[model samples]
Target: MLIRLAIRDVVLIEALDLDFSAGLGALTGETGAGKSILLDSLGLALGARADSGLVRHGADRAVVTASFDVSEDSVVTGLLADNGLEGEPGEPLIVRRIVKADGGSRASINDQPVSAALLRELGTRLVEIHGQHDDRGLLNARGHRALLDAFGRFDTGPIATTHARWRAAEAALEAARADIETAERDREWLDHAVAELRQLAPEAGEEETLAADRAAMQKGARLAEDLGHVTTHLDGSDGALAGLRQAARRLDRIAHEHEALATALAALDRAVIEASEAEDALAEAGRAMAFEPERLDAIETRLFDLRGIARKHRVQPDQLAALAEELEARLSRIEAGGAGLAALERAVAAARTDYEREAAALSDARAGAALRLDKAVAGELAPLKLDAARFRTAIERLPEAQWGADGRDRVEFLISTNPGAPFAPLVKIASGGELSRFILALKVALAEAAGARTMIFDEIDRGVGGAVASAIGDRLARLSTKAQLLVVTHSPQVAARADRQLLIAKSHDGTVTRTGVRLLDEGERREEIARMLSGAEVTDEARAQAGKLLAA
Candidate 1:
């Protein structure tokens, strides 16, 4: 509920701070007493359109601030989080709007800077303002469905889930159709590529192995002479191993003659053994480097085929296998299009059936709820001097294109002000005075269901008096039981019903004027009501009537 409002340099308002409480509060004043200015100030804080002319004549700017207290689990908390704004759940939501003399505006919430658009978005969660020309409340057609659904206590979640599944089915069918279309466009290329890849049967690691083998085979032919030269030093005709072997034989024969001779003979034998081993290694290497043109040709052919195919596909040699697999899969899907399409179509049909069932149920629930709502609102009219007015909840089926998860129904509150009158929309059919009373009837009907913590009506008792005015007051008081209600009224009967009353008045200091509000005490309230009852003069009879009204 709105907790406080402050205004500065706004038209006739100089500096004002009004603290509000939860209940049926009334603001009463004579004409030109700045009551409208007070509401305008509140509207500015709620992100209404700014006007430079609203600023005081000698002031640089005008400012209005409104604060509200809401529950921790309210949608407001989620909205704040979604917008990246920090909020403490226990603290009041303070929204401030400042209008510059040059026709500019700035907005803030909880002293943190915000855009005016954002402030307005938050305002809808906290306060609902209804006037003759207001459209944001029940008058808006977009909100009618939700409002009706909320009132009916109907859960639309199932419909939403079913709709989501239907949409998913649609997406799948589209994709399958798109795949078929694309495959039709690329049929020839796909067939050729798949056939070539199947024939080649490329392996993931085959490219590197082939390249290495090709390099070894090609380089081995070029290094044949150099390899032979190295072999000659160890195992060829000019190798030193023959001389060492001849020396070892001679030394072994003399080894028995002397100990020193035996040592020398042992060394010669060991050297001969080492020379033979080294010669064997050189001979093995000579075989490894042996030239073979036919083998080299085979390796070159394999490497060239792999590299050429990879380049043709504009892929790395290693990725060729993966590319081949992907193409094979797409081709397989295209071939299976008939069965796949049939399955998708069946799934779409099933999902649509599911959605239709749930949507039908929701539509039935709305029809039932609309009947009850029409009855309830009609019951409220006669007491408010609208006995002949016919209230209706129009539940019409929307076109196929506008069908939604909430069902295919378009719900709107319509009215007929006279007998035999064709029903028209609520906003279009009512006069200024009639609209206010109609708004009052709606408030009485939807206050608890609206989910708005604060409901403000401007002069809802306009052009009403006696028992009709009293009836308006009675309904306003009942609405306050559901939520915080504030009404600006001229009727003494309405003023007498307030849980708290504020008298808006103007005062002058020197040449300057200011608007202010004061909470009326019991005595002051009686006098104020008397003034309302008797016009400018509070006669004894008016005071007695005011006393009786207050007592009642």
Candidate 2:
């Protein structure tokens, strides 16, 4: 319920603060006395569009703050938690908005900054404004389905889930069919490529190993002649080893004759031994470095074959193996295309069946709920003096192409104002007053369903008077028992029914004009109602009638 509204520098309202209780409250004043300005201010706080013209003359900005008391389980509380705003069970929820003269605006919930869109989303759950010109709430056919579901207390989560699953299945089936068709078109190429790869299978890293081996063998071929020359020099009859042996024998013959000769003979013997060891080491290296021409030819041939195949497939040597596996898998899928496509089709059929079952059940339930709703709304119309009118909840089964998560049915509220008249849409057939009354009747019918805590009716009693106005007032008061109701009315009958009455009056201070609201005391309320009854003048007769209306 809306507990308080504070406004500053908005249009004709310079500054105003009003506290509201939970019941029927009436704002009564003459036309053009700024009753609409108050509603606009409240709308601004509830995230309505901002306009620079709303700023009062000579003021740079306009601010509006609305506070409400929401229960812990109310939709408003859930929205607060969703937005990270503070709305403890025992505390009030505050929504504040400021509109600048430059046509810019900002909003906050509980002092935490928020976007205008978020504020608007939360506002819908907090208050619903209904009037003859309203396009939201009950009048909008687009929201009719949701209103019906809420009235029926139906949970639509299951059908929504089923519809999503059905769509996914359809998508999967389409993709599989496309894949099979493309693979069939390329069947010949896949077959040839897989065969070639199988015949000359290329191993990973084989190219680099073969190239390195070929390099080593070619280098060995180049060094073979030089190695032979060094071997001949080390082991030839006139080489360094043979000369060392001849010198050692001569030195040994003379060693017994002189000490100097013996020392020379020993050094020559050591030189001969060193030369022999050098020859052995050279021989071992020659054996290790030897290369055969046949082996070199085979390595070159293998490398060439690998490179040619890689170029043919538009891939490197190492990637040929992976590419081969992928092609083989595609070929296998093609061979089994008939079975795979059949499986996908069956899956899609199953999903469609499930969706249809759930959708049919929901449609049946909606039909039943629609009948009950029509009955409930019928009970409300006569009291508001529309006994000749008929209300209908029209549920049409839409075509399959238009099926959706909501169901296969389109629901709209239709009415016929006179007997034998065909039922037509609410907007097309009803006048402004009739539309307002229709909306009221619908609201009363759906009152038991969950909805916004506060409902504001803008002149719902516009064209009616006397008993009709009294009936409207009585209904408004009755509706207030379910939710807070604030009505802007000119009917004295309605004014007499209000638990609280506020008078909107405009005043001018020579050069400046302003509008203010004053809560009426019992005597003051009686006078205001009397003024309403007598038009600009308050006669003794009007006062006596006003007293009777209040006393009754």
- Tell me the TM-score of model 2: 0.79
CA RMSD of each candidate after superposition: 2.4, 5.8
How many clashes in each candidate? 0, 0
Q: Estimate each model's TM-score.
A: 0.93, 0.79
lDDT of 1: 0.87
* lDDT tens per residue, model 1, 367-464: 99999889989999999889999998989888978877777889988999999999998888889889999988887887657567888899888887
Q: Which stretches of candidate 2 lie over 4 Å from their true place?
A: 1-4, 19-23, 45-51, 65-126, 204-300, 307-316, 492-499, 520-552
The CA lDDT at 191 in model 2 is 92
Alpha carbon lDDT of residue 318, candidate 2?
Answer: 82
Name the best candidate (by lDDT).
2
User: Model 2, 1-552: lDDT tens per residue?
Assistant: 899999999999999999999899999988899999999999988889999999999999999999988864457777788778865558888999999998799999998999999998888888899988888878778888988999999999999998998889889989988998999899899999899988878788898989998888888788889888887777788887888888888778779998888888888888889889989888876665668899999999999988999998889988888888999999999999899889988988998999999999998999999999999999999988889999999999899999988889899999999999999889889889988888888988898777788999999888889988998888888889999999999999988998999999999999989999999999999999999999998999999999999997
